[model samples]
Target: MSSSSTSPGRDSKARAADAKPPMREALVAAAFQLFLERGYEQTTVDDIVALAGVGRRSFFRYFPSKEDVVFPDHERCLADMTAFLAAGTGDEEPVGRVCDAARLVLGLYAENPAFSVQRYRLTKKVPGLRAYELSVVWRYERALAEYLRARFASRRDGNLRADVIAAAVVAAHNNALRSWLRSDGQGDATAAMDHALGLVQSAFGTAPPPPADERPEDVVVVVSRRGAPLWRVVQEIESTLTRD
Candidate 1:
């Protein structure tokens, strides 16, 4: 909802006026600051509004509810993640890319560690916030699943297999990230994420086979070198061919 109703024909200045950091970021920063100062429950939306230098109306325009402030750019993060997945999260080094995306989310917290820590504490104490956060995590997992489904569309299991793989990836990422955040972002978090994902590959029990229909049954021997040393191997093959 905009405070001004100048109408569409009001000219470009009106639009420019409406264009006001995004109000969302401002509210998040304001709320985060208040949470640090007065504590989570002690701080009110009014406090956030006052701190943001915006009216109550503007605050509501940006966030549907007060709890939304804790998430900040969660929607934007999902969009970025979707873009990453679409760009081939299925590289030869898929696990690497998945871990990189995990780092991106972690870095969002690192961008404002103090606020992240505060929010973390609040979320632990607040059931509602905790639930909301978990849902956000699931959104990421679901996106990964859809991406994998698209990447391996030709597989028999297709989306089902993708769902399982995505679940494993998401779990690994969250576990590693939470451990790192608890330790104040210490250690090789990326490596830890990779280690977790490695389990997925091992659990699958086989290397990824060639794409369906790309291989034919039975065998054809092009060249054999069971014994004969070095150059002798080629000589043996030539001799066999000549004798035939």
Candidate 2:
């Protein structure tokens, strides 16, 4: 055979290799498969690397630990949320902006409903994963709170209001998200999220328009000390904000 005749076969082989999954994706696929086949505890990093045909160093390069692999997209999602909050136009209410940030999270899960449901189930069964997930959730909550604090800094109760609204948004979003996950990712998740956010708006949002037959009370927001823990401030603000 001539050299030109062999060129096509070599090019096809090169293209086939180029089209193969990336190392990170291969590791994720191998890890999940092993975790499902053998219980999470039964699987090890070695097994994952072996299945992926990659070395242990390669696995570590992609994921810090086995638990990290379970929730691979968290860092990306958190960055996206932070960016969205940072890009706020200053025209929207703080609560509304926070609600919009929470929607980013919902959109992330909705993009991969099947994987979200499976990962939710796996996390429940693994204590380490549950703890990791909690820490990730707190990161998201903190991002929103930081943005709100800057928005409300001039107000008397700025810090307190920021923490409270942040917690409330996270709580409402989780409640709606968990309900959808529990149902195996069925139904309209966006609709459920809207309803949950509306409740939050009613409780902590700007005062709604009063009926023509009634008078409107002047709304007042009380500020708390800046040195206190976020959770304490959140509790105090929540109790005060939810009052009829």
Highest TM-score scorer: 2
Q: How much does each candidate deviate from the true structure in C-alpha RMSD? A: 8.3, 13.7
**The candidate that achieves the highest lDDT relative to the unseen native structure:** 2
Candidate 1 Cα errors over 4 Å, as ranges: 1-26, 37-42, 89-99, 201-244
Determine which window of 10 residues in candidate 2 has minimal summed lDDT: 12-21
Poorly placed runs, candidate 2 (over 4 Å)? 1-21, 207-244
Residue 30's C-alpha lDDT in candidate 2?
A: 88
Model 1 pairs whose backbones collide: none
Q: Write the per-residue lDDT of candidate 1 for residues 1-244, one digit (tens) a residue.
A: 2234567776553364246346667788788788778877788899999998899988776677888878866766777777776676265445445545665776677676666666777888778888899899999888877866776689899878778877887787778767766776667666776677677766642454677898666443446557757687777656766662
lDDT string for model 2 (91-148, tens) is 6777888898999999989998988898888888988888999999999999999999
Taken over the whole model, the C-alpha lDDT of each candidate is: 0.71, 0.85
